[model samples]
Structure formats: structure tokens, C-alpha cells
Target: MMLAILIICSQITIPLPGVPLTLQTFAIGMIATMLPLRDCLLIIFTYLLIGSVGLPVFANFAGGLPILLSPLGGYLIGFLIYGLITSGILGLTSRSSLTICLANFLGAASQLIIGGLWLIPANHLTLSQAMTIGVIPFIIPGILKLFLVVIVAQRLLKARLLAR
Candidate 1:
């Protein structure tokens, strides 16, 4: 549900070679920390399925197998890893603000890895070149996203705790 909503709100465009500022990453991290690992993966996969079927589920209102086959496809696949890593890390932590932040950062790193892998072959880039084109440009934004998602997750968890 959240992924669908985010997809509609967001659009896909590779400002760089492999990195797009879609809400997919943000949504993945948020869902990972909030939902169970299985559910998070389901949501990630569902989003892709929607996109693959030409639902415009990608960023910039782009979708279809063409997008998936594109360099950004790696990042799309990375969303699954992002969700799994974030959810798993949060599951092991004490549900504290600090740990949630750590989880988000780790999730972001995982997404970067996926993005880099996608860029290398798709863009004909080396590791260092891929990092420059696929990873470096997005670092600041990704960090900001991690901080924001952590803050929101912490607040939500805190509120739930208070409610209990």
C-alpha cells in the first residue's frame, strides 16, 4: 500500500547513470524497519511486478520491462535487499533511535552495492567508475534519507510504545 502510494507520488529518472531519486529506496527502508522481513520483501516484489506489467510503478512514471532491463533495473532489484537488510537489522536491534538509524544506514549501503553492480555491466563502468557515477552523486541524498527515515521510524516506534 505504501509502496504503491509512494510510486504514484514519485517518478523515475536517472539523474545519474544508475541512481534515481525515487521514493522506492525511502519506502523500502521505512517498510523494512516497520514491517516483518517477509512482508517487506513481498511489498518490494509487488512494486516491481506492478512496474513490470506496465503500471508506471517506477519513478518518473516509468515502468515496463524496458526500465527493468535498463541500468536502473539494478536499483529496482536492490530495493528487495534494502528491505531485507533494514528489516533484519531492526529486528535484531532494541528498537531504539540509534539502532534504527544504524539500520537505515546499512540498508542504504546495501542499495548502493546493488546500484553499483547494476551500473558496472549496464553502463560499462569499472568499480571506481561505477562508484563515481552510480554511488557518489547520491551519497548526500541517501544520507539525508537515512536520517529522515530513522527519525520517522523512531518517532513512530516511540509513539506505539507510549500507546502501549
Candidate 2:
């Protein structure tokens, strides 16, 4: 069910220069908060596999190795990184709203860092340029999403609709 939500969220995209703004991070945050570490990781890996095999499971209905090889690929790979890191944090600490918020934000930061570095080579951009186009533009929106995820996850956890 969460994997399906993630796939649907990936399609909800707003295209930018280097990367598209999608609900992927938000969904990832929720998944990390609600699911076990191993399960979250598996879902992410499966999502990537489905996208890689030309399933149109990516933003703007794009898929296949070419899309995965694009500059935006890092962001896609970043999803897995985000999932693992957030899941690890959630596993090690309390599943309080504060902890969830912190873990999700950290995961977002990891995504930006990895994506920014990958952009340098894939887009033939300088480090500063990559940060400018890839990371900076997304910070505010990412924070908003993190906030939303924290709130929603907390509610779901309280309601017993989601696993801690």
C-alpha cells in the first residue's frame, strides 16, 4: 500500500531545471516513520527497480536506464538514501514527532548533498551552480513537506493506523 502511494506520489511532479518537485520525499518520510527499517528499504529498492525497467514510475511518467542515468538520477537514488537514513534514525531513537521531523530533515539534506554532487558531473555544472539549481530551490518546499509528514505521521501513529 505504501509502495503504491509512493508510485502515485512520484507522478505528482512539478518540473524544474534539474530536478522535479515531487511528493516522493514526503511519502518517504511517512514511510520511514511508519514502517520497519527493512521494509522501508525494500519498498524503496523495489520502486527504483520498477522505475529502472521502463515502467514509467518516475516523475512526468519517465522511466528506464536513460532516465536513471540523467542528472536527476541522483535525486532518484537519493530516495533510497533518504529511506535508509531516516529508517535508521527512527529505529535508533524514539518515534516522537520531534525525532521523525529531525530524521526526515536529515534525509532531505542527504538527498540534496548527494544530488548536488552528482549534478556537478552529470550536468557539467560547478559545485556552486549545482547547489544553486538543485539544492537551494528545494529547501523551503522540502521543509514544508517534512513538517507535513511529521504531522501526518504523528496523527497516524496516534490513531493506530500506522506502525510506530
Candidate 3:
């Protein structure tokens, strides 16, 4: 179910250079908020594995090692790390709004940071160029998604859908 959700989210893309903006962050947040770290990692790994094997599970219906190694590759790789950090934080600490907010922020930052760094090498871009396209543009959207995830996750947790 989560795997399907990730794939579905990937298709809700607004095409952009380097990487398309998608609802992938939304799905990633949901997965991070709702699942245990171990389970979350397993799910993210499976999602990446499928995409890497050319299942068209990535954003813009893209898949394969080429895509995995492209300028957008860091974000793809960052997803797993994002899952690890966010889910691990939630697993080990209180699930208060504040805690969730911090975890999400840190995890999201990790994605942008890693992705930005990857762009420098992959695209042979200067740091400023990578920051311009990779990190700066996504900050506000990432914050919005963070709040949405916190609200939805709390509600879902209260509803006991898989139980936190």
C-alpha cells in the first residue's frame, strides 16, 4: 500500500529542470510519520529497488540506473536517508507536534543538502547554481509539507491506522 502510494505520488509532478517537483515529499512524510524506522526503511528500499530496476516508479515515470545516477539522483538516494532519520526520530522520541516538526525539518534539510551536493558533481555545477535550483526553491514547499504531515499523521495516529 505504501509502495503504491509512493509511486502514485511520484506521478503528480510539475516538471522542472534537474528535478520535477512532486508530491513525493508528501508521501515520504506520511511514510516517515506513520511507520516504524525498520518498516519505513524496508518500504523505501523496496520503492527505490523497484525504480532502480526500471519499473517506472520514480518521478515523471522515470526509472533505471541512469536516472538513479543523474542530477536528481541525490534526492532519490536522500529519500532512504530521509526515512531513516525522520522515522528513527519519531520512533525514539515523543510524537508531539514540536518533535515531529523538528524531525521533519531535519529530514527534509537532509534531502535538500544531499541533493544539492549531488547536483554540484552530477551537473558540474557551482555551489551557487546548485543552491539556486536545488535547495532554495524547495524550502518553502518543504515547510508547508512538514506542517501538513504533522497534522495528518497526528490525526491518523489518533485513528489508530497501524498505530504509532
* Every model's TM-score: 0.90, 0.95, 0.95
Give candidate 1 regions above 4 Å deviation: 12-18
Misplaced by over 4 Å in model 2 are: 161-164
Residue 48 of model 3 has an lDDT of 89
Root mean square deviation (Cα) for candidate 1: 2.0
Ranking by TM-score: 2, 3, 1
lDDT of 3: 0.89
Candidate 3 per-residue lDDT over residues 1-164, each given as its tens digit: 98899899999998887778898988898899889999888988998898899999998888998988999899989998889899999999988889888888888899888999899999999999999989999898888988999998888887885664
> For model 1, what is the alpha-carbon lDDT of residue 113?
80
Q: Which residue pairs clash in candidate 2? A: none
lDDT of each: 0.79, 0.89, 0.89
Cα RMSDs, all models? 2.0, 1.8, 1.8
Model 1 Cα lDDT, one tens digit per residue, 25-60:
677778888888888888888889989999977887
User: What clash pairs does model 3 have?
Assistant: none
Q: What's model 1's TM-score?
A: 0.90
Instruction: Please say which candidate is ahead in lDDT: 1 or 3.
Output: 3
lDDT of 2 by residue, 45-70 (tens): 89889899999888888889898899
